[model samples]
Target: MTATIPLGSRISGERLAVLLGEWRRRGSRHGSTDLAAAVEMYVLDGQLPIGTRLPAERELAAALGVSRTLIGAALDRLREDGIVASRQGAGSWIAGTGARRRDLEIPVTDGIFDLAKAAPSALPGLTAAADAARHDLAAYVTGNGYVTGGLPSLRSRIAERYTARGLPTTEEQVMITGGAYSAFVLCLRMLAGPGDRVLVEQPTYPNALDALRAAHALPVPVALDPGEGWDLAGVEAALRQASPRFAYLMADFQNPTGHRLDAEQRERLGGLLARTRTPVVIDESLVELDYDSDPLDGPPPLASFAGELSLTLGSASKSHWGGLRLGWIRASADLLDRLLSSRFAVDLGAPVFEQLVLAAMLEPAGYAALAQRRQDFRGRRDALAAALGHYCPDWTFTMPSGGLSLWCRLPKPMSTRLAVSAANHGVQLAPGSRFGVHGGMERWLRVPFALPSEHLSEAVRRLSLAVASVRSCAGVPAVNVPVA
Candidate 1:
């Protein structure tokens, strides 16, 4: 039986207006065309998700301060494009079912440069680690190899790493999963239920948002600034107003923006959530990937402040290698038990060999590998920045202190169009709105620096071409085209 989604029944008028940020392009003749394009972009980017009922035409017109006729014409354009479907009595909804469509994904063929993923390639030592793990795997293969709580040795190593990082944890407090994303889904299931509120930072990791949506949780977004990082005041207000059951945060080297919470901000957040008694799951997957910054000098884990109310999630995907597919949750023993009990419904446990490989990577030698990885990422980041400056000078982005990507702003609010254009030119780009909760941030883009330096240069060149294509279509002058 397909369970019904509890939330996303109807979008508020005010929310719809915010989603249609700066929808009207300069020199655009028709208001209806502009509105239709904006709504199409919103649905394509998964902001106004499929099956989400749009606000009434009258209500939207009032919110947008436009005439109802214009709203009706806009909906008509959307229906013509197959972006929206409407019935006489049931009202209008985004086209197709709420589930994602595979056809929407760009094919991974030759000459395609995919910057959609912020993951790095496997480390130099991965093969050696896998080979070494085979010897260790022999011991586990003698049994059924179906341990629910994960291998004791691997859990101990993960817990010790957490303790070394200042958040004292025990092996019993850790629950292993296939990857950080899996751990996030598990935590969401254990922490929240249908119709429960989950507070999150705006422009967070896209997959995290998908997990929340899949769990049928109502996500309340707090605005996060690329320049200033978290808007603590806004977060505090949301906590006080919504009193959400659970909160999800990326406190260290945040995804896309690479914004880290300072000590004072962490302290303030801790106090607010403590008073509200809201349980938070902090994703620290990129914690060890600090570039110019030193983790030793940075703020302690947010879990250290909230004590039992906070759960810290860590992964080897960023620091070590993505192929490892290893992640763990650091929480109280009671919470760990609950996670373990709930985990069985999904799977028995992660593969035994991969756990051994991860355990080996957590040793002293692995720390040395991490240092090398950090240096490599720093170089790649600098390379990407230099390439973007040379090729797409109009694009603006802060040089990230850490993490694998830069949250860039285009000269115009054409990120969705740019993404489509880039894909046609054999480059896969994640549009700015993909990170946003609603359809805002249309002027922004997430450019990953995890590729090789040469690939980074090539990507920027292709992106420059894509930008020219979009601008030309918009009847805007394309100046300063970089020579490839």
Candidate 2:
């Protein structure tokens, strides 16, 4: 017999709860049937995409505030419908769409509105910068083109950037990489190993969690409240108890949460790391997108507070264009050496032309576009908030001072279900469950302002329809059965 390879990322019980909002009808006797139909809706809509693993029965019962018998019965119903498959030891997964597909009335639309990613289009003037870099590339054409550490031009620009942000970085401290995520991978490789505990925010950038797991590093989560911001006491305890090898943090306009660690908070957090003698990788990918104040006038980079133990990651993906595929790491000279030495196992170096393009983008002349990009994003951010207010009145969110997405708290814990229904309405979403480590946060959703205003408005309108559809699903009566 073959061992079970993972079907796909496991959907935690708490996450499944978010997907099965109000599954049972009031006073319905056949709760198992109701639960099964709710689960079936997700499967049919491709929300629980094929091969997606499901929570264990006991876990599901706890999450849904029901009994295991109810969950088991529901699973049985699902299996009968041919929508799910299970093995004794391997748990269960979505297997097929079942025979009900043709009967459902799925809303039709020509194009899908995507709010699943926070990435924006290339900064205006990227083409002009690329053209300038194209001419500059001729000089490097004569060389081997592998600047392992990074091209001096790009490194210096990034170094000065750190200085402006109050880190006092030098050219020697920075190592350019393919992107912020790549920079994270390189650091993860150098600092952690299998079974090692790496501290992280509870609802963090999902990709970072994936990378940490891929490296076999166990992530120790510290709870983060979107409204309240980081809980330093909790972080301090996790550091002391878990003794994580290092922490991964995003203090500036933190992803999905939009909570910035104020200067005082950073000082306190930095001191905690210093006292713990723990190293940290601070992902500053969203640092440049501040909407209210100058990025410089804001709190100093957390690295400045954290001292030598911090490894700071910066990227052009959010500020400029993702296509440039460029980011860099600022670390102590000694740590930078180790990260550089570890690069041999990966590809040679970041592509030469892209690096040059980023270099040109960082030039003094290119800052006008950066400012313009920020203005454009600020407008987009307000547009999304307005749409949400207009279309989803009960969906509450703090107006983020920065960041490309808004973290909205839904009136119902129907994020996953709403996502499935939204897909039918031609709108894509990243539900709150994707951000949590152990699978929860069902009451929330992250909506990006990356689309045009018209598109954003329409998407929210469709989302409002999806919300209604979910309500309709909850209202459908299940086949009668004797109550246990």
- Tell me the TM-score of model 2: 0.77
Tens digits of per-residue lDDT, candidate 1, 1-484, equal 3223323335668878976889987443588998987787655444554446678888898999999998999888887766677876677876631212222444456978878878888876777788889899888778998887788999998888778777888889888888888888888988898888888877788788777888888787666665787878667767776778899999998887889888788888988888888999999999988887556556788988875878888888877777778888888998888888899777788889999888887777877888788899999999999999999998888887889888887887677678777877788877665676543456678898888999999989999988898885652111111100
Model 1 weakest lDDT span, ten residues long = 475-484
Error of 1 at 146 (Å): 1.2
Model 2 residue runs over 4 Å out of place are: 1-110, 472-484
Candidate 2 — what's its lDDT? 0.80
lDDT of 1: 0.78
Q: Model-by-model lDDT, in order?
A: 0.78, 0.80
Off by over 4 Å in 1: 1-103, 474-484
TM-score against native, each model: 0.79, 0.77
Best by lDDT: 2
